[model samples]
Every structure is written in C-alpha cells, then in structure tokens.
Target: MTSNTSAAPRAARRRWATLLALFAILLIGAHLRFLSLITWDEPSSRLHPDERFFTDVASMLHVPASFDEYLDSARNPLNPRNYTKNNWYVYGLLPQTLTQYAAVMLSPQQVLPACVNRPEYSDPSITIGQPCQDTSLADYQRKIVNPDLAVPKLVWLQQALNAEGRDLTGYYEIFKVGRTWSALFDLGSLLLVFLIGLRLYGRRAGLLAALLYACAVLPIQLAHFFTVDAATGFFVLAAVYWAVRCAQNGGVISFGMLGLSIGAAMSCRVTLATLGLLGVLAVAVRLLRRDPLPNGQEDTTDRSHTAISSPRQVVTLSLLLAFAGGLALLSFRLLQPDAFRGTSFIDVLPDERFIENIQRISTFVSGEADSPPQQQWAGRTPFLFPLQNILLWGLGLPLGLAALAAWVVAGWQLIRRGNLAHLLPWAWVTFYFAWQGGQFVTTMRYYSSLYGLLCVLAAWGLVVLAAAKHLPATRVRVPSMVAGRGVAAKHLPATRVRVP
Candidate 1:
C-alpha cells in the first residue's frame, strides 16, 4: 500500500514537471515572436495588402450605407483600371464611413459630410518649382486650402485620442496592436499543436512536437509579422489534425469537423486546397483496403482493387450537415464576383505573368536572378532562412536512413508489437518532402509544413535509437544458447532445474 501510494506521487510529480517544461517552451515562443514584433523594421510600403483589405471590410461592417456602396462598387468591373487604381477609393471609404457613423452616434455637430470629393494626396505641392502653376489662385487663398482631409472614422479616432489626450498619428501604436493580435493567433496555433500531439502521440511526444513547432524560427518570425501566412498555417495544421483524428476514430461527427476545418482553412488561404485532395485520397485508400467505415459497416470484399466505398456519399452527407450549421464560410474573393472577373475553376490556370513571377523568384533563390535582388540576402542567411533551410531541412535525410535501419532490425518487433497508426504520420512526412522537392520555388516559408512533419519523424527516430540502446543482452544470449543446444535440450530440461 505504501509503495503504491509513493509511486503515485512520483508519477504525479513527473507529470507536473513535464507540464512546466511545456509551459516554459510556450513562454519562450511568445517572447521570440513579441521581440520580433517590437524590434523588426517593417518595410514602409504597404504590408500584407490582403490584410489591409480585411481591416477595411471589418471597419465597414459598422456602417450600412458604406457597406452597400462598397459591395456595389466592387461588382461593377466596367472600368477595371479605375477599380484597380482607385482601390483606395473603395478601401478608404470604409474607414471614413465608419468614422462618420461613430461621430453621429457620439457627437453630432462635429460631424461633417462624407469626404467623397477629397483631392488626391499626390496633388502637386507648392514646394515644386512651378510658380506659374494655377495662375488664377492668389497666395492668401492658397494658404487657406486644407491639405489634410478628415474622414469620418479618422475624425472619431481623433476625438477619442483627444479625450485621452494622446497623439492620434502614432503609427507605431496601430502596428503594435496588429502585431499583438497576430501573436495571439500564434499562441492559439501552439495550443492546437499541443492538443493534436496529445491525441495522436502520447503526452511526451505531443509536448516534444509542440516545442519543435513553437521554437521553429521561420514560423516564429512569420507569426510576428502582420501576414496571413501564420493564420493560414494555423488553419492548415488544424485541418490536418482533425482529418487525421476522424480517419482514426471513424466517426460521422469527427469527419464533419474535418470538413469544417478544411473549409475554414480554404477560406483563410486558397493554397490549402491541397489538403482537400489529401483527404479524398486518404478516404479512398481506406475504402480500397476494405477498412471498416466510420459508421461501423464492413466494406465489401467482392469489389476489385480499384473499387472504393463511396466517400462521396459519406462526405456529401457530412458537408450538408456542416453547411446547415453555418460553418461553411465562403472566401471573400469567392463572394465578391466583380474583383475576380467571374473566372470558373477551369479558367483559372497559372497565367504567363504568374509563371514569370515564379520563375523570377526561383531564379532569385538559385543565384541566377538579378543582382539587386541578390543583395537582400545580406547576413541573415545560413543562420536564418535560405542557408538554414538548405542545411537543416535535410535533417530528414539522416532520419530516413535511421528509419531504414530500424526497418531491418525491428521488422519482427514491429510486426508483433508496433502500432500501425504511426504509418500515417510517417507517410505524411515523406509526402511533404517529396512535394517540396518537386516545387519550383525553394523559399523556406514554403517548407514550413515539411519542417513540422520532419519533427515528428525525428522524435520517432529518437525513440527507435533509445530502444536499441536499452535492449537486454541477457535476452539475446538466452535465445542464442537455446538455438545452439539444438534437438535434445527440451527433452533433457527436466533433469536439472536450478534456482539462481
């Protein structure tokens, strides 16, 4: 009784210690991301043009008239050049319209007409050496012209700033808030990693996987920046995790969750459509193998190798339920018909310009692009990205070798005792690397998913090595001696049975 009670406390204490270590890793990840947020110099030019658009849409949600105009204006592509060049007119109008609405709600008299007729900021300044410009304008009249126009939203933001007696033009503050929000998303991503790891592998493996994901430098840097990459990555990981879980558990609800996650990931970034293909392949493979369905029905064995149980039937029902729950959110671009020119899926092939862009980026990475672009690789390489990725990204090479070694020694051991569930994770890692090798562009950011998959295999490799290290010599010797004794040993064994 005392031994049992004592053992329980030790186990509990070890569990707590493990939890502390994971929490420490989480804190370190947060610090690394936040440091980048505060110190990193963002290019003064527009950052994440897509996210800027999202903010505009969010702001416009507070006002009705502006939202209607914004939607209507987006639909009329009769003037594409006007739409593209004057995108600011549509984008800027949201903030202004929202501010106007705010001012009316908070302070009415200060409200002015919406500044739809505002002059462009690029209008020639007096500093230009053209004294004869606008000859009808008198000097005193020119001085009275207001250079700054107050949009309604800006006005409300200004008034709010004044109420707090703070400077309204602190660009850094807005950036800081955006950065903080991005970091929070990173934290949420880490939490999801931990949960997935715990569910897929045991607690120790889960913690290790989460640590690897959180501490990965490139993903960390991306998380700090106000970019959609981090958000897209989070959803990608979530979709993969839930899909794997559904596959393992074989449940209708689990599969529904998987679809929802995949849809959300698609909404976040269209590139994640790859996951949809992977999902279909996984389900099809299961059905071909005559695996039990999620509904607990056994697959028909009479079907040929090519025949698969209808995933369409399963997935279609799941999608219907998911959409009924309002979880199937469409992409903003998908809903806005005018901007995308109503191109059908079949028409949206990679264009010549896109191919040229990819080729340019590829050449830049491969040291064959323009000289000016090459200068961007100053000191940050070898340690941070291109160099680190080229070097450490091949860490999987060694792991592949180790896995081969394990296959030789542990073939019987695995057949007898190993969980086949591990194959899914290992296959995913292999597929990721294979995909990376075939891609034209070799940016480190593109390999983030590969990096994650490798970490899991690395952990598996460590476990294999540790088990080999601890193999009992006595067990090996006993088997060897029994083999050497040959035929008569079993018959003679009863003659002298000795206690050690």
Candidate 2:
C-alpha cells in the first residue's frame, strides 16, 4: 500500500519532467530556426533562388474577387502555374500560398502605396485593385513602429508600389514573414516527431528523437529559408504519424484522417504521394496479422476461427482502403484546387503542367538543358556525391552514422521478425535515399522530408546503445589466507557475457 501510494507521485513527477523536457526541446528548435533568420547571408542576397521564386509569386497572388474568378484556371492568381506567363511552376502551390496569405493578414508596412496619391492610376499587371484607404498602423491599435496589422491593405499597396516602378519595395518584410512561417512549420515537425516516437517506442525515445531533430543541421538551415522544404517535410511527417495511428486504430475516422494527411502532403509536394503506400502497407500488415478489434487487437494464431473471419477481414480492409483513397483525392482537389482544370480527380493526378515542369527541371538537372546552372553537377557522381554530402555536411558525421546504423538494424529486424516498427521507417528511408541519392541534382534539401524518420531512427540507435549491458569479466582473482602464513591467490567464478 505504501509503495502504491508513492508510485503515484513518482509518475506525476516523471510526466512533469517529460513535459518540461519537450518544452525545452521546442525552445531550442525555435531558437535555432528563427535566430538571424533574415540576415544570415547579410553580405550576399538573403533569398535563395527557390525562396525568391516562392516569395515573388506569393507577392503577386491575391484573393479572387468572385467565385468565377476563383474557378478560372487561366487567370486565378492563386495558381502557381499562372504566376508566370510560361506556366513553369514545379513546386507545390500550397506552402507559398499559405505563407503569402498569412503575411497579408499578419505583417504590416509603414510606406504607403504610390497609388494612394494617384487614385486613378491602376497596375495593369494585377487584376486585383488596392482599396485606397488612409489607414495608419495606429488605427489597429498596434505599435506603428512594429507594423503588425492592417497587413492585407499594406501588401496590396506594396504590390501597387512595385507596379509604380519601385521594384521589390517592402519585400524584406515579406521575406521575414515567410521565414517566420518556415520556422513555425519546422517547430511543428519537431513536436510531431516527438509524438510519433512516443506512440511507437515510449517517452525516452520520443524525447531523444525530438532532441536530435531540434539540433539537426539540415532542418535548422531549411527553416531559415523561405522555401517550401520545411513545410513539406512537416506534412510528410504528419502523414507518417497518421498512418501509424490508422494502423493501430482501425476505424473510419482514423482512415479518413490518414487520407486527409496524405492528401495534404500531396498538396505540399506531389512527390509525397509515395507516402500513401506506407499507409496501405500499415493496414495490410494489420490484416495479415489477423487483428480483429478496431482498436489494435493483438494477433492470434487460433486456426479454428481463421477461415470464418479471413474473407470478412479482406472485405473490410478493401472498403477502408477505398474510402481512404476517395478522401485523399477529395482533399487533394480542395487544397490544390488550382492544379485541377476541372472538378474531377483525374485532372489532379494527370497534372500535365506539373509534369512538364518536372521534365524541364529534369532536363536542367541531367544537363540536357545546356544551361550554365547545369554545370553545378558537372563532376558530381549521383549516389556517392549525395551520400557524402549528407554524411559530412547535411546531418554531420556522428548523427548520420547513427541513423545509417539504425537503418541497417531496422532492415535486419524486418527481415528476421517482420516488425512494422522496423518496416515503416526502413522502407521509407531506403526508397527515398535510393531515389533522391541517384539523382544528378541530389541536394540536401531534397532529402529534408526524410530527416524526421532518420532522427527517430538515430534516437532509437542511441537508446539501444545506452541500454546495452557491458561484457562481464571472464575471471576474477581472489585472495585466500593459508594457515596465517601468506595470502594465496584463488580464482573466483565469473561468467562471460555473450552477444549473439
């Protein structure tokens, strides 16, 4: 009774400690990502080419005036493809769109638009007109110096100002906003990684994994830029987390949520559609193991009932998969509405614009484009170059080695025991590494989505290493007194520790 009473306080203390640890991890991640965000490349251009592209196009985007304008594929400002006359958009539209919208709603500016003076003047380039108002930052009760609210009007006015030949006026503020969003997304991934680890392994693994991710070089670097990599990586991890949940809890809601996550991931980057296969694999594993309960019933080898339930289980799995697929398609259409020319899911899947841009990018990367930038990979070996970069620069040597070791261990365990815990991460890391590492354009950002899984695996390896017992002494020497003369040496039994 005394022991039981004391255990409660101990558990409470542990929970508080875990929460405190998680909070510290988040603070560390936030600081790493957000510190010197806009001025990291102070002597050079702060924006990467991709960052420039996303923010440039985002600056041009505006809410459609009408429902018809929203549906118009040719003129929809939200569409990345329509942002340029050549229709040459390759990256996901959702991330930049969200950033720009958030910036419009959240960020403010002091410099008024040129159009404020010339009320009759309009920018022919943008269809959306700026609402001429004499609103100051003080109107919204925010500090005029901080420039916090009245953002939409300010952004529109900035667009108008740009139209008046002040090129990229007030863009630094927008870039800062974009960087803020990127940092937030990365911080979110850190939390998701912790949750995934907690769900899969336990609190120790979760905390360790979160710590590794928070301190990783690649994620921190990516979060500093206004590019879509950080947000895309977040969605990818979200899909994986939901997939694991669906596998554990078989129900309509779980499957639907998983589908939505996959769809959201796809909307971020179409390459992430591959994660849907992970979901399918999870559900298939559950079925093959013959878990009957909706909430993760343990597999049983009771052959007597197998014949009666096998067909039912198959049908149920099929229905769930079908429902999930439909929801995935639906969410994809809704989130990436501009990708579709019509209401059909067919338009989104066979997105010819995306395909063409991808081909063009491939041509550039493969050196077929004959562009000067193509020379970057002139002496680069596909697989080895990427691997070397990831080890030496991206993840750093120690963590990278740990993750690689974890991957090997996971693959071995999957082969030996078919553990889903091993299977899911191993399959993803293997496939992603093979695909991305084989590319001539294998940059570290391309593998950003894999960081979450790698960090988790690294933590797993570290935990395993910590928990391992040291080898026992093979023999021990003991002293014995013989008839008060001298101490005689004797052997004490000690078993040798063996590792299989």
Candidate 3:
C-alpha cells in the first residue's frame, strides 16, 4: 500500500518534469525560428522570388465587405482566380489571404489607401517625390532627411510607396509579418512532433523528438522565409497525428479531427490531398480491429474482432467515414473556395483554371518545361538525388542515418509484432518519399513534412536502445520469505517499464 501510494507521487512528479522539459524545448524552437525572422530586405535588396510574388499577390487582394461578397465566385477577392492581373495562381490561397489580412491588421498605417481622387497616388508605380493623400504613408515619405541618407531607408520608403502597383504600401512589412507566420507554423510542427512521439513511445522519446526537430537546420531555415512550406508541413503533421488518433480510438470525434486536418493540409498544397491515403489506411486498420490500446498495450482478444461483428457495426463505421469525408469537403471549400468556383452544390468539381494551372505546374515539376531551374536537375539521378540532399542538408548526416536505421527497425517490428505505432508513420513516410523522391523538383522544403515523422522514429529507436541497455537479459535468483515461513529462491526475469 505504501509503495503504491508513493508511486503515484513519483508518476505525478515525472509528468510535471516532462511538461517542464517540453516547455523548454518549445522555447528553444521558438528562439531558433523567430531569430531574425524578417530578412527579405536584409544586407541588400535580397527579396526572395517566392516572397516577392506573395507580397505582390497580397497587394492586389481585396477583402470582401460581407460574407455574401466573399461567397460570390466571380468577384471574390479571396479566390485566386478572381485576380485577373496574374495568371500564375498555382499556390494555395490560404497563405496569400492570411498574410494579406494579417499585414493589414498588424500595420494598418503601413498600407497606403487607394487615393482614387488623386490620380498620381492612384498609380502606385509612379514614384512619390512628395507625400500622398494617405497621411499614414506620408509620414514615412516626410521622414526623408537628406540626399546622403541610408540607401536601405530610401529603398524601403520607395518600395512602400510603389507597393508593386497596389494600394498596400509596405511590401517589407507584409513580408516581415508573413515570415512571423511561417515561424509560427514551423513551431506548430515541432509541437506536433512531440505529441506524436509521446503518443507512440513515452515522455522521454517525445522530448527527444521535439529537440531533434527544433534543432534541425532545414526547418529553421524555412522558418526564416515567408512561404507555404512550413504551413504545409504543420498541417500535414497535424493530419497524420489525428489519423493516428482516429486509428487508436475509432470514434466520431477523432475521425472528424482527422478529416479537418487533412483538409487544412491540402489547402496549403494540393499534393497534400494524398494525405487522404493515410486517413484511409487508419480507417482500414481501425475497421480491422488492429488498433493498439490507448496505453500502448496489445489486446490479444481483439484478434477475433478483426472481422465485421455485425451489419449495424458496418453501417455505423460507414456513416462515421461519410461524416469525415463531408467535413473534409466543407473545410476545403472554406479554405480554398476558388477550387469550387465552377461547380454546383451537388456537382463538386474544381475550377477549370485551377485544373489548367495544376496541369501546367505538373509539367514544370516533371522537367517537361525547359526552365532555368530545371537545368540543375538535368544530370541528377531521380530518387537518389533527393535522398542524398535530405541526408546531407535536410537532417544532417547523423540524424539522417539514425532515422533511416530507426525506420528499418520500425518496419521489422511492424512485420514481426504488428505494432501499429511503427506502421502508421511508415505508411506515411514510405508513400510521401515514393511520390516526392521520384519528382523532378527535389527541393529540401518538399520533404519538410517528413521531419516530424522521422524524428519520432529516431527518438523511439533511442528510447528502445536505452531500455534494452537498462534491462538485463538474464535473471538472478533471490531468496524470499512468505509470512513467517522461509521460501525457496526463484529466478525471475526483470520486466521492462515505460521510459519516464
């Protein structure tokens, strides 16, 4: 009774300690991500090409006055298709809309309103030698002290006025705020990695995984940029997390979360629509009754429950999956409404323009288009190129090898013991790598979603190694007494416990 009572407090203390460690890991991750968050115009006029495009696109956007206006497919500013000026609307609408609104809210004064009354101010392309009607922007123009002033200061003010021919004045401010959002998204990935690891292994493994992801070079570098990659990775990990949850629980709420996460992921990158495969696999595992218990325990009796128990059970499962699919459609519509522009409620089809753009992008991505960037991959081997880069730069050598080893170990465990914890991530990792590694554009950012899963696998391996090290193979005999009588010595094996 005393041992049991004391064990509770020990466990409670361990939980508190784990929470503290996780909090520290988050802090470290935040520091790495947010450090020098805005660097687009740093050193020189070094604007990232993608960031410049996003800023320009954001400048052209107009927020709808009401919900009805937002829903109007033809005139909707939220829809990338409505932007008649630019034909290149391939990227997701979420980041563009988010950065646009976020910039306006955070720095309202930075935006120069459309001075339609003043033709000179109306055309942002014309250099403003004098202050405009918008008094907020005028203040910056008024701050020009002398001809010998800093070049960057003059450039910043001039760019703010130009706004690439849009009413929103400060491109720098927009990019800066966008970079902040990117950092936050990457931080979300870090936290999700922790949670996934914790779910699969234990507290120590979770912390280790979080630390590995936080310190990874690629995620940190991506966090410094204002792009969709970080957001895409975050949502993808979130989808994977919820899919794992749905597999374990087999409940309505879990499935709903899984669908929502998958929708959010696809909204960032259409390629992420393939995450539906992971969700389907989870559902299949759940249907087969192969899901592990919440405490990571195997249910020997559940083996017989693999087959459908009754027609009612089948009907219930079907309805739950339908609800999930419906939610996914609704979430995608809300996030990327432009994709549903040309379709009626009953006939859900993506816009023709969106499809065309996707097709065009696919050709470019597949090296069919003789673009300058494609030249770099001219002689590069298909799968091996991405694999080597991911090892060298994405995860670094040690972590890359460790993750690879862990994956092999995980695969072996899955085959031998049917461990779903290993199986879930392996399915995602294998599917994603197969698709991405075979692609022509093998940028490291494309593999950002794999970081969380790989870190979890590596951490699990480390934890397993530690457990094996601490637990002895042979048992020792010890003499014991029962009540008042002496008992014979018996040899008993030491049992493995969960890592704290």
Candidate 4:
C-alpha cells in the first residue's frame, strides 16, 4: 500500500514535468516566430513576387462582390473573339474562394460593404464606349501577374473588390489574418515531433528535439512567414508520428490516426502523398519481419477468434474507420479536373518526362544553374546555406559547429547500432539534399525541413554522448604504476591492469 502510494506521487510528478516541458517548448517556438514577424522581410515589398499573388487571393476571398466579378471574368477571357489569344490566370481560385467565403462568414458587414461599392473598371484597351479592344488594361494586369497562364480567378476577384470601394488596407488585414493562422500550424508540428521523440527514445530526447526544432533557423523562417511550408511540415510530422505509433501498437486506433495524419498532410501539400506510401511500406515491412509483441505472440500471427472480439479490436476498428473516413474527405480535391494539370503527377509517372522534370527542379533548387537572364541566384549553396545562415542569424559559429558535430556523431552511432527505424527519417533529408545539390538556384528557405530534422538528430546525439560520459567507471590498478615502484619482494603486490 505504501509502495503504491509512492508510485502515484512519482507518476504525478512525471506528468507535471512533461506538461512543463511542452509549455516551455511552445514558448520558445512562439518567441522565434514572433521575432521573425517583427524583424524579418515584409511581404509587401521584401518578399518574393509570388507571395503577393497569395495575398491577392486572400483579399478576393474576403469580398463577395469581388467573387461574382471574378467568376464572370473567368468564363469570358480577355480576347473572347480570338480563340487562340492567351489569357494568363494569375491565382489559385480554390484558396481565394475559400478565404472569401470564410471572411464573409466571420465579418459579413465589413466584407459586404467593401464588395458592394467596388469601382467600375474594365481592361483599359477595351473602352466602354468603343468596341472592346483585343484586350483590356485589367487583362494586361492579370496576364503580367500570372505569366503561368493558370488560375485567373484571384485577379478578377481583386479588381471587383477594388471597384467596390474596398481599400487595399482592409484586404491586407484579411490576408495577414490568413497568414497568422497558417503560421500557427507549425506549433502543432513541433508538438508531434516532441511526442514522437519521447515515445521512441525518452523524455530527454523529446525535450531536446523540441528545443532544437523550436529554435532551428529553417523552421523559424518558414513559420514566421505567410506560406504553406509550415502547414506542410505539420502534416508530415503528424503522419509520420501516427504511422510509427500504429506500427508499434498494431491497433485499429493507431492505424486510423496514421491514416488521418497522412491524409491531412497530403491535403496541405499534395507532394506529401508519397508519405502515405511510406506509411504502408513501414507497416508491411514490420509485419513481414514477424517481430514478437511484448506479450510473446508473433505480431503477424492470427488471433481472430478471441482478439478480434476484444475491446481493443473494437477500438482499433473504430480508429481505422475514422482514418479512412478522414482520408476520403480530404481527397475530395482529386475529383477536381483542374487540380494537378500539366504536372508530372497527372501526365506521367516514373517516365522520362517525370525524370527530366525532377532533374530540372533539382537543378533549380541547388544553386548550380546559371541565373535566368532576368534573375540571379543569391549565391546560396544547398549544404552551406543553412549552416552559414543559422550561424550568422541565430547561434554563433562555435555553437553551430558543435551542433553539426553532434549530429554527425549521432548519425554514425545510430548507423553503428543498426537503428534503421531511427535513420529512416533521414532518408528524406538525404533525398532533399541531393535534390537541392542538383539545382542551379538553391534558396536558404528550401533547406528548412532538412535543417530542422538534423537539429533534432544532433540533440539526440549530444544526449547520448553525455550519458556515456557520466557512466560510473570501475577502478583498477595499472601496470605502469608497479613499474615505477621498482621490484620489492615484501612491499610489492601482484600488478593488475585496468580494464576499461
């Protein structure tokens, strides 16, 4: 009874410690992102031109008048008479449409007033009194902004909102809100990394991983900005965590959670659909290995009779159902014809065309290609970019070097231990690194995910090293000490060598 009472107190203390650690990690991550928000590049002028397009989409979503106009304009191209004439569609319609719908729901009065009074503007070339010219000023603006010639809905939405007397400031605020919400997704990703580390290794590993991830330059940069990368990271981590847990537990709930995580990640960034494949492969591999469970039963052995009817099986079934249901819900975009158009995913798979595109993308990401006639590669090499930036921007050279060394040692130790499961995460890191190396123009931002992963690995390595050093040593006499004492028949004892 006394022992049981003592155990309860210890358990409560551990729970409290875990909660405190989580809160601390979140606080650190928040500070890193908030610092960037205050001091980092501004979107209006400093960010890449593509960022403006996303903002424009966000604005269009906030106003209804803009939505109607955009729809009408989309159906009727700038040069309706000339069927061959090119009309660039500058923004993604879905994101913008959803944003506008959400804004309208949140603050209808503010959004409606701006949309209702929008100004009457047409393509400049197409005068109101004169016959419509080949193209209008509005069409030219759309074409210039969206040279890709896809998704013109956002431009139309923007024009409509402007016409309705909605100033750019109001639209900007709405965009900011969207960006803020998107950034918060990174916090969720960090939390999953912590939980996964804790489960796989221990509390120390979890705390260290979370701390390193929170302060890591790449995650910090990505999280502070109004981009989809943070969201993508969150889903990727979630999917991996749940999938690993399911593989370990072999329960329906675990599988369901895994599926849901993968589905959500894919929804955030379709490219992450590869992770779903990885998840399935992980489970299949584990089952094939026929590892025994803690209960002594072969993991792959059937127990359909009693086990299937058990409460655990029921819970597992429910989880699987939820996961499948969530995935089905998220995959609704697959039905949309316009999605993935012109991309390799739609046109080819493992074909020459796909390979060539991959090569080109790799080249573009690696900072190896000559800069375009109009643009320059900012002299950022894929491998060196993260190291240099993190040293200069966050930690100093000494600390950065220490971190790198720790990571290298940890990777080597993991390899020595034959911890393939732990090393599996780094496979993606290696792929990204190789992909970036082949690119002609690598950006510091592109290496964010890799850097974040490595930092956690490095922290784990440091923890291991520290533990080994602290282990108590059994003292033993050295032969060298006897040699110095000279031969004395009565005083000298038999020499013994130290066993390290």
Top candidate when judged by TM-score against the true structure: 3
Q: Highest lDDT among the candidates is held by which one?
A: 3
- lDDT per residue for candidate 3 within 334-443, as digits (tens), equals 77766765334443576777889899999988988878867887877888998898788999999998898889877765555444556578889988899988888887
1 or 3: which has the higher lDDT?
3
Spell out the clash pairs found in candidate 3: none
Please give the CA lDDT of all the candidate structures.
0.43, 0.66, 0.68, 0.47
TM-score of 4: 0.62
Please give the ranking of all candidate structures by lDDT, highest first, separated by commas: 3, 2, 4, 1
Provide backbone clash counts, one per model. 2, 0, 0, 26
- Which window of 10 residues has the lowest lDDT sum in candidate 1? 487-496
**Each prediction's TM-score against the native?**
0.54, 0.77, 0.80, 0.62
Model 1 lDDT tens row, 54-114: 3333222222222222233222222121222333322112122222233334322233222
lDDT of 4 by residue, 1-500 (tens): 99999999998999899889889889988877766562466545526444554554344322222222222331112111111221222222333333344344444233332111111333445322212233535443233221111222344545544345343324455564445545677777678778766654456767887887787666776666555566667766776666656545446666666666665555444445556554553453243232223532212233222122346544554555456555634442331112322122233122232234446544544544544731465654545665576556544464466556755553553344223335335555555566555455555554554554555555555555565455434222211101122211110112112211
Cα lDDT of model 4 overall? 0.47
Q: Which stretches in model 1 have alpha-carbon errors above 4 Å?
A: 1-19, 42-174, 250-252, 281-390, 393-436, 471-500
- Model 2, runs deviating above 4 Å: 1-6, 83-86, 107-170, 290-309, 342-352, 365-368, 470-500
Residue 171 C-alpha lDDT in model 1: 31
Which scores greater on TM-score, model 3 or model 4? Answer: 3
Q: In candidate 2, which residue pairs get closer than 3 Å at backbone N, Cα or C atoms, i.e. clash?
A: none
Question: 284, model 2: CA deviation in Å?
Answer: 2.0
